[model samples]
Target: MTLLVIGGSGFLGREVARQAGRSVTTHFRAGGPGRRLDVRDRAAVLRLVEELRPDVVVNTAYVQADWVTTAEGAMHVAAAAAATGARLVHVSTDLVFSGRDVTYDETSVPDPVTPYGAAKAAAETAIKGLVADAVVARTSLILGDGDSGHEKFVHALAAGTASGGLYTDTVRCPVHVTDLAAALLELAGSTYAGIAHVAGADALSRHELGMLIARRDGLDEAALPTARQGSGPLDVRLDGTRTQARLRTRLRGAREFLAR
Candidate 1:
């Protein structure tokens, strides 16, 4: 199948493109191994989608702190893909939900407390409205290959370059990037639309995850500072039961992936 991957240079996006192999055509904004196409430019996105007419468009493009790039850009990509009759698979995050809820499922309504979360939730809403058959994969902290932002933070802390304490109460389901990419590719081929919680099987706290990483990497776990999460909603653990039931691939937990 002909596939198009937006933001193919990102941590998760890069993995998706790599796993997709030769039939995939990738797009990047500033710098990457693919053609430069800004998702923020609606006309550009439309023109590219129309020209390529890919069977599926997987949009993983996102700027860390830019709301417009995260939300509006996603809408543009989804709309263009929909117009071209391309199956869209948009990668999302668990931050969309407020920490008030103990755990979130695929059916959970988004009540984002943070700006990033709100933007992602908005993007999800826009994609659903624009693409009827789009698959919105809401995943959690992606950890693998020590290249993701989360891993960089852990590495910085371990190397004494960073000095922030990790939250003991802040909970999340950290999935391996490889597993998440594989799942997204599988979902891309299916007709499953709407939200799917594609995350790790085990829920862990930030401090706990730090310790696990430190232990796995032969770093001093005790050197890592620890603190309780603030009053804001800290628990964003996603329920991956629905994803597991839908896909043949098993979403392994952090413990399993990091237990080298």
Candidate 2:
């Protein structure tokens, strides 16, 4: 399949590419080439898509720094996807929801809390308006190598424990980058159009997850503080029943992901 992976160099994007490459070889078909194009630039995005003429365009580009960046970024990407008539699989976040105590499904209305959540929710709106054959995959706290976004959580535990303690109240359901990437590829190929959830199997608090990581890595989990708290939403677990039904590869939990 001819595919265009935006933000192809990022943690999840790279894994999607890797899986695509391997899938192609295993299936005895050639995977399409990759291009590192920023989704925020309208002209550049349109030009790249027009030139590549890919059958599927997967957007993994987004910024957490500000709402403007994400809103603009996703706008151009959706536009490019519409212009090219390509199936667009846009990666969204679970934060788009209000982070209410209850677990969210695809049907749940998004009531974003933080600026990041609001930005992603806005982007979803733009994508839906622009493309008819678009699928928005809403994932949560992606965990892979510490080099990825997981570094923030990893470091937080290390630093918090070194100083005094860590927050046990905040909770999240973090999925493996590879698993999320696989689901993205499936979404790109399928006719499933709309927002879908993709997250880890179990819900875990920050401290519990940290302890698991510490124990697995032979770190001092006991030294970590039993009480740590942060601002914003907690317990933003997603119900990925739809994703689980569609994806071929088995979705893994944080423990299985860390073990890998």
Candidate 3:
């Protein structure tokens, strides 16, 4: 099957493309292994989708600070997927929640408290409206790979090269990029629809997660300073019990993966 992965240069998008078997990947500014197509341009997205007519389109592109790229850009991709009748697997975030609830499940409605969250939430809504059968997979902090931003931050913090403390109150279900990518690809071929939580099995604070990563990498765990969150959501935990039951990929916890 021909798969199209948007944001192929990104951490998760790169993994998605790598495991996609037969796939066409796209990048924005970064030099990608495949084509260069900005998701912000509706015509370009439509043109690529029309030309490829891929069986599946996994949109992993999003700019946290840009509304056009995060929200409107998603609309363009969704429209193209709709036009081509391709199965879509959209990557959403746990930030979509406001931490008003203790934990969020597939049935929970988005109540975002931040602009980034709002953008991601908006993108989720648009994709659902365009592709009725699409999988709106909401995930948490993606790690596991040492190359991921979070992992790199942990390494920098340990080396006393980075500023800022890991928030002790900021809770998240950090997932392995490999597991998340594998799960997303499996959902691409499955008939399951609607929002699905694809995250780690363990719920942890930012500081605690950093400690795990530090220990795994043989870094000075004590060097990683800790602090409380300043604003926004604090304890937004995504419960993936339902989605995990349906997937073949084992969504290992941070404690498990980092321990290795």
Candidate 4:
């Protein structure tokens, strides 16, 4: 199947493109290993989609601090994908939920407390309105390899280069990048539409996860500073039971993957 991966140079996007193999066309913003396609440019996105006419378009392009790129750019991509009848799989994050709930499912109403989360929530809403057959796969902290910024931060913290302490109260289901990519690829060919929670099986606190990473990487866990998250709801653990039941690919937790 012909596949188009947006933001292919990104951490999760790169993994998706790699796993997708030869039939995939990758698009990146600025400079990367793929054709330059800015998602922010609606006309450019439309032109590219019309020209390629890929069977599926997987959008993993988003800048956490940039609302225009994260929210409006996603809408542009979704619009083009809809116009070309391409199946769209948009990657989202668990930050969309306000940590008040214990666990979130596909049915959970997004009450984002942070700006990044709000932007993602807006993108999801726009995508659903634009593409009827789109799959909005929301995940948690992505961990795998040493490429992701999160992983880099963890490493820096372990090495004493980063000053901030890991939060013990903040909780998340950190999914491996490879597992998430595989699941997204599987969903790209399926008829499943709307929101789906695709995350790890275990819910862990930031400090707990840090300790696990430290133990796995042979770092001193005691050296890693730990603190409780501030008053704002920090628990953003996702309920991946729906995703687990839908796909044959198993989503392992941080502890499970690190043990390997």
Q: Assess every candidate by TM-score.
A: 0.97, 0.87, 0.97, 0.97
**Per-residue error at 184 for model 3, in Å?**
0.4
lDDT of each: 0.89, 0.75, 0.90, 0.90
Residue pairs with backbone atoms closer than 3 Å in model 1 (clashes): none
For model 2, residues 1-260, the per-residue Cα lDDT tens digits are: 87777766667777787888733211101233443455556898788778877788887777688665587788887898899888888989888876675688888888888888899989998988899668988888777766664445556656663453446777778788888888888777888888878888978886777777776666666656677566677768899887788778567888776762
Clashes of each: 0, 3, 0, 0
Residues 1-260 of candidate 3 have per-residue lDDT tens digits of: 77888888888988888887555555543575678888888999999999988899998999899999999999999999999999888999999999989699999999999999999999999988888999999999999569889989989988989999899989999999999999999999999999999999999999999999888889998899998987899999999999999999999999999895
What stretches of model 1 exceed 4 Å from their correct place?
A: none
Candidate 4 all-Cα RMSD: 1.1
Rank by lDDT, highest first. Answer: 3, 4, 1, 2
Error of model 2, residue 84, in angstroms? 0.8
lDDT of 1 by residue, 1-260 (tens): 89999999888888999999998998899897789988889999999999999999999999859998999999999999888999999999898989888799999999998888999999999998999889999998899966777777888887889978889988999999999999999999987888888999999998888888888888888778887868665988899798889998789999999885
- The positional error of residue 156 in candidate 4, measured at the CA in angstroms, is 1.6
Clashes of 1: 0
